[model samples]
Target: MLEIRNLDYRVEARPLFEGASARVSAGWKVGLIGRNGTGKSTLLRLIREEIAAPGKDSPIRLQNGARLGWVAQEVAPTDQTILDVVLEADAERHALMQEAETATDPDRIGDIHARLLDIDAWTAEARASEILMGLGFTTADLSRATREFSGGWRMRAAIAGALFAQPDLLLLDEPTNYLDLEGAAWLEGYLRRYPNTVLIVSHDREMLNRSVTHTMALEHRKLTITPGGYDDWLKLRAAKLAQLESQKSKQDKDRAHLQAFVDRFRAKASKARQAQSRIKMLEKMQEITVPIAERTLPFSFPEPETKLSPPLLEIEDAHLGYGPQAVILKNVRLRLDPDDRIAIIGTNGQGKTTLVKSIAERLPLLAGNRKVPKKVEIGYFSQDQLDELTEGDTVLEHVMRALPKDTPVAKQRAVAAQIGFSHEKVETKVEKLSGGEKVRLILGLIALAKPHILILDEPTSHLDIDSREALIYALNDFPGAVLLITHDVYLAEATADQLWLVKDGKVAPYAGDLADYRALVMSSDREKAGATKASADPAEDRRRNAQARDTAAPLKKKADAAEKSFEKANARIRTIDTELARSGLSPQKMTELSIERGKLEAEAAKAEEAWLMALEEYEAALKESAAS
Candidate 1:
């Protein structure tokens, strides 16, 4: 369904893709993987046509009439219900259903019904709901207003909409970054059964191994597609590299022999002709291309100098949550020794984060006592800690804060360098750092504490595969205790010796491995499905259908028009950017293109604003209709 030909792209003087080409057939799940900054996201933008190819001959194309879909930016906060937003994502279905509602002619009504059935319109709500549920939304969340949810939850809703749309080719970039272990597992199963073509960019090795049919590697400025999953790709790549090395060694030996022969025989008249022939042969020989060595950053978690005793940290019968009324987990008894390595697993909102926070001493216990030695130290890593980093401060400044005030400046710089920061990167401001860099900086700061216990929450979300492996090694080598909460099962399996499950308002040890946990999660899905089927009521459905007919149809039409206008302007802006980037353009032509791009950007912004206004009006009307 997608084909790329001679794709060559450069960011200023740096080349990201050179003569990279790949073809993806319909219905294949392909995983796009490489080290960070290898331009995976850039290739996706090129496919979406938001950024044009460098030349006409270097085209990224999709089959004619093929629908392309990705997770769009979160919608504007509105009174629109989550289900409505997902249903609206399938514009075709929405238009047909609207027409079906207003049609009067018998033949027209029959045609509309036929089309609706063809698209499975009758099951659209259930399908949307299922996707949302798998992504961590509760049953009651479906009818809740979008404004009521946090940004992360809204992002989940956006993901649900994309899945509900079911475009011919779906593009997902690190989809599991926002998901919990349960949600990630559900997504893995969903992608395996997805009917359309899917190309995902991810660093989750487990997902890549289990979900994709093919693995596409971007390396040495080229794209290579291999059959089978990530493990298969690794084996094939290893063999190919080894063979190339052997061939290069043999070629080098032959070249050296030829050179030696030419040097010795060129001065002798008897072998002069042979020497000339040997020189010609040497000149004609092609050099074997050796692949460049990949550089990966190492994670260093310094071991505590003083080993703390057993039960270094303990929470006894603690009720963990925000406050007395908001206790999320109760009767929890957990302890961390100096050498413990534990991984927490559960669905979102099941108190995984809550339990971790309580252990880290970030959250207060509503009831029961928490005890820790006065000399014991804990290093905590969380997404919130990343946000708490001072944006205006340099990396060095953050590291300095973590160290003692009397510590030497050279020692502070040494600590930063130990955690994989260069001299230049140490001076870089926090706001200028990339997501991965920010994560590294946080870890560096955490390393400064030399804590007896480390409590990490989703530490690998922004990390690449190599970096994650580095982390696993670091965690295993560290002398301190570790408590990790992450969706990356690979990391958990590699590092954690004990698995703790937080479910049903309690924390307990799980006897099974990750595979067993996956099975349990899948079985829960089946049970939830059975419950949903058993709970269906025809009377409630009729009432909802009757209410939906009263929604403001005209407002929706206006919103659709505005959305089209915004898309057109955005497309024009992309074309303008492509034109402006062309080489050897006249000054006058460049000026004109720049002016046009400015105008198109403004127009696109205006159109988007109008669309949002129209959408809000329609949502308000719909909410009132439903309430009535």
Candidate 2:
């Protein structure tokens, strides 16, 4: 579906692609993977023709008449509903429907209708809804105005539109960054079954392993396409590297021997001619250029001076929600031991974050007790923690600020270096740092606290595969409790020995591994798709409609009530954010406001969870009623 030959590209004076050539066959799902800042997104832009490859000889070309689809940006806030936006993505279907409405001739109208049928236009809404749901949107959200959704939700809507369109060649860039575990799992399954060709740039290992048919490694300013998934590619790449190393070693030995012979015999008349010949041969020989290995830094977390007792942190009969009526998770009992390595998993809005925040002591319990040793310290890392960073400060400055005022400058620099920052990078301002660098800086700051427990939420979202592997290594080495919430199944599988699943408003031990959860997610998606297909029967459709009408009313009332509570809490949190942004607050005042904001966020989350649960209940009741 696509071909590139000798792609020579440069940004300013820096070379990104130098004679990089690769071909992607039709119907292949290719994962583009490399270290961060290697121009993966730039390659996508070139494919989309948004950026020029800059020569008549530029050879990045899609097959003739092939359509290229990518999400350029989040869907703009508009009055149009989500479903309408996605349905309109299918240009042919939309055009035909528009023509059918206005066509004067009976024959023309018939032709339009026939084309629509060929395109399955009648089921466009259902297909669009399914795509949106797979990306973690609700059925009710399909009817809501795009203006009502957040930027992330709108981005998912745009992705859904792209999938609904099903263009000949699809390009996705880190498509799972905004997704929760369930959504990511659903998307992985969807892409594995996608019919068209896809070129995706992702740091998600699980998706690359499960969704893509091929792995395209972008390294050394070139592309290497390998059949099969990431693991397959890794194995092949290892073999190739090993072969190169062997060749280089043999070549080096030969060169050394030839040089030694020339040096020893060049002055001897008997061997002078032979020495000259060897020297000429050595001069003519080409050096074996084995590619340098990519540098990956290890993550570091300081071991605590004292080991906390077992059950380092515990929440007993925790009612983590807004209040009695709006509890998202009730009677929840969880414990974190000094040596525990736990991963929290669930669908979005299912209380994973709520449980984590409660465990981190960022959220106050509505009606429960939290216990932790008075001396025990917890280091919490969340995406929001990045916002707390001082953008104007340097990496070294941030690290220095976290340390004792009396600490030596050498100690501060050493601390910064431990997080993979060089002396040059230490002086770079936080605002100029990339996402992964910012994550490292935050991790460094977290390490300085020497906490007994660590709670991380989606920590690997900005990290590349190597960095993620480094993180797994670090977590395994750290002598403290680790609680992680992430969509990256690879990281979870590597770092976490215990699994906690948040489902149906409760947090409990998961009985299976990551593979089992993956199967469950795929099975759920299949069942949903099958249910959607079953609606094709006219009698069944009519029966479902009548039953939905009967059961939806009471449930809708409950959902609306929950939504209102959520909105109220959410508005307050926004107001607090506004206030916090204002200048000239005392440190004491800031601390109080920050505390209040955390509690309010937890309240808002609980209310939102309650709302979602009510909505799901309503949908389930409608489906059950219809089936009966």
Candidate 3:
């Protein structure tokens, strides 16, 4: 059990939390939800002990010696391999392994080795690799140094790392933000069967619905916990609110009647006692407090300046990538027109972003042209644009900068208000703005552009549910064409009228909706798991798997590297030997050839030795793989 008693926290003088209390049981996956800046993150920090909860003693308590696993919003990029980075989070396994390797005492080393097996250290790499893959890291990615990955990939690694730790309590903040639908799907399954408690703050509805067994909503400086998922919680909350409102109304009427009795009868000697008693009752009455929902952040995009009928933009056999040589999205034939709402869906790294960039003309197509109707204005919303905002500028300043130079300050403030920034929030520095605020600011800038076509990539990544719903409603009502690429299936389903699937280096229309795609993915995963299980006999499988961990893994890695070098060495010698095989040569040429051959022979000997060692290692791996 976890208890938060008088969890008082404050920002400046304002009480974000005066005295909040919450209790959660073991193994409960609770979805923490609230409006942006409503202290949800702060509550998580207090739970993680990252910050102090403003009380004398610690406000949070965990029974049964529980451990905490927290996924950081940002992590320093490391030079360790992705697999190594994830496995490093399993502190027990890492410690045991280190002790086993370095301890000079045989008894100590034996004890540590036993503990390593107890912690399943031998299979840690494989488990870490699977988790990494589930989060969309490729086989090649598992080997690559973390420093080679982009910030988003590093964030994924962080998520995988925290999951790999498998603590008694898991705190994930927007865990799916860096994930694609598939990755999010994997996460949902992972959390559903998680052995311990989970407290996650995410706007992804599917995740909330599928993983969370409970919801803890922080609003108006109070934390309220209820059983069931987000929708279930909302339904119960609504009913509770309605009941409270009714009670408040009845209480108000009772109080009014009591006051009327007191006014009418207080002057009469016989009725004065009764009136006084009624007055005392009125004074002692407890007011019924009707729960109020948080203030709404309602905003909408400005209508597009231009509208093109069908085929406003068309990409014909287009290929999208960086430069000319690196193509990520290929054979992409997609068309959109005004009134069309298309959501592009695919696994991460399958080039959804690239396809959008190609359609938006932000990146040149590698193979074919994208034809766009003349005078069509495109508003492409990307996180990169948000990154380009001036650091020192205020939210209002960002909007005004995008507006016409002659626009008045009053008009600018109005525009900012229209996009959800109000009062002092408008004057907040760009750097101080929360992620969702920055996203809206970027959207506000786009609203000013008034483009005919809107291309949004992961637009809801930073939005709370309220803001996400608002955006969906606005986009659904918008007249312009929309090309959206998002992992937020809820937002995608709500906003997109048509579905486009990006897969196998091509883009095409998806015949069904997000739900259908989800089913297919789930079925595919099951089939893969089933096939893998069916392929091997259970006892033999365990033995060989253990053998692979003990022998094959190290040997195969060494062998794979050595084979590459051997191939290169042999290729070079072939070229040199072929040159020496020429039929006729001058005496001077012969001398030069003989001398070169001598040097080449020494090099070949060293290469041969290395290659032989590699082959021996590979043979050992093969034997392990084939063990009975």
Best by TM-score: 1
Steric overlap count per candidate: 0, 0, 0
Model 3, residue 160: distance off in Å is 0.7
Q: Considering summed lDDT, which 10 consecutive residues are worst modelled in model 3?
A: 527-536
Q: How would the candidate models be sorted by TM-score, starting from the highest?
A: 1, 2, 3
Q: Which ten residues in a row have the lowest lDDT in candidate 2?
A: 529-538
C-alpha RMSD of each candidate structure in angstroms:
10.5, 6.5, 15.7
TM-score of each: 0.85, 0.84, 0.82
Residues 463-528, candidate 2, lDDT per residue (tens digit)? Answer: 999999999999999999999999998999999999998877788899999889878876885457
After superposition, candidate 3 runs with Cα above 4 Å error: 73-75, 525-628
lDDT of 1 by residue, 287-357 (tens): 99879789888888888878777989888888876544345688999888877889998877677877887
lDDT of 3 at 102: 72
The runs of at least 3 residues in candidate 2 whose Cα sits more than 4 Å from the true structure, single-residue gaps closed, are 267-273, 323-325, 529-628
**What lDDT does the true structure give each of the candidates?**
0.84, 0.84, 0.78
Evaluate model 1: give its TM-score.
0.85
- Pick by TM-score: 1 or 2, better one: 1
Better of 2 and 3 by lDDT: 2
Supply candidate 3's per-residue lDDT for 260. Answer: 97
